[model samples]
Target: MGLDDIKRRIAAAEERAGRAPGSVTLIAVSKVQPEGRVTAVLDAGHRVFGENYVQEAQGKWPDWRNRWPGVELHMIGPLQSNKAKAAVDLFDAIHTLDRMTLARKLAQQADQQGRSPHLFIQVNTGDEPQKAGILADELPVFLSSCHDLGLSPSGLMCIPPEGHDPLPHFRLLRRLAHDHGLPHLSMGMSADFESAIAEGATHVRVGSAIFGDRA
Candidate 1:
């Protein structure tokens, strides 16, 4: 599927879910994709994009931002604390604020820079030991710590365990966001975005379905 196809599908999902059109942001994941394919979507008037690596985004997006006015970049991968300054400068939103160290780093950078990107807490709803997210049971405490550090996350994000039904995970994330008074839910991808929309996702990250598979 291409950008237009994904947008149309998102629109349909919104209609099905009784959500207002354009309420869900579509973050076209551009990590590791070629310049040609990435520019193709840019030329198509899509401005929101996601990247998984700080260095990769640093190398390309500065030029792309100049070329494409109004472009918005999101960091959707695990964020290392050492890269917090660079990430805070480069991304318009960060969907992977999991650990407290990274949170403190981001907060310090934000204070130093006088501005900060929108933040989303990545929750390990599946409790996968290998994943990089705050476990569901630990989110409240983590969130409180973040607040104490002066970092306010506007949303919650999660990647459900592979091969499992994602609806339950989506519902859990939505509930978590609600319980915490967070307004946004960044969940879903090309495969389960429709289900996510139905479960009240405010943002969806789609990669291969839009930019084609990475080599």
Candidate 2:
């Protein structure tokens, strides 16, 4: 599993799904990997990457961005309200907009900074108790609240319950996004990305398949 292989698979998935070439953005999740592995991917010309923590990204990406032009970073992990400001500044997109407090913080930060990153509302399609996402049933209200607060999310994201069939979850996310009129669907990872593409995923986060297992 390497970058080119993953990309070829993505292209095939898009073809099977009737999506245009390059419709799916492959976000190489670089969180928790060694810097050398990240640089290898960067050297391979992968500019779009994902990070989990604000502090870890803040520590490394500024220098990397200067080294590699056109780099885009996405925040693909749980975000705390206190770190909203830094996350806003560092990430080009944030995929875990699940709570009102975080949404309010992001809105305020966007106002102060005069620019906002792309947003994706995380929906708990499986309704897991420990996950960091809004329950599917609550999305209408949550999305309405986000709109009232001036935060217009571009899509919907979800991490299906581990070890279960992911197709159902992916289909659920697709439905939610369609119902809400959102165009992007960030609902896949390394294992189920092909299924997600079939279900209309616009973004697939691949970490180990590209960089190998975390160090």
Model 2 bad stretches (over 4 Å):
none
TM-score of each: 0.99, 0.99
- Worst ten-residue run, lDDT, model 1? 206-215
lDDT by residue for model 1 (65-166), tens: 999999999999988999999999999999999998899999999999998999999999999989999999999899999999998899999999999999
Candidates' RMSD to native: 0.6, 0.7
- TM-score of model number 1: 0.99
lDDT per model, in order?
Answer: 0.95, 0.94
**Candidate 1: segments with Cα more than 4 A from true spot:** none
Candidate with best lDDT: 1
Question: How many steric overlaps are in each model, in order?
Answer: 0, 0
lDDT of 2 by residue, 102-141 (tens): 9999999999998899999999999899888999899999
TM-score of candidate 2 on Cα atoms, chains taken together:
0.99
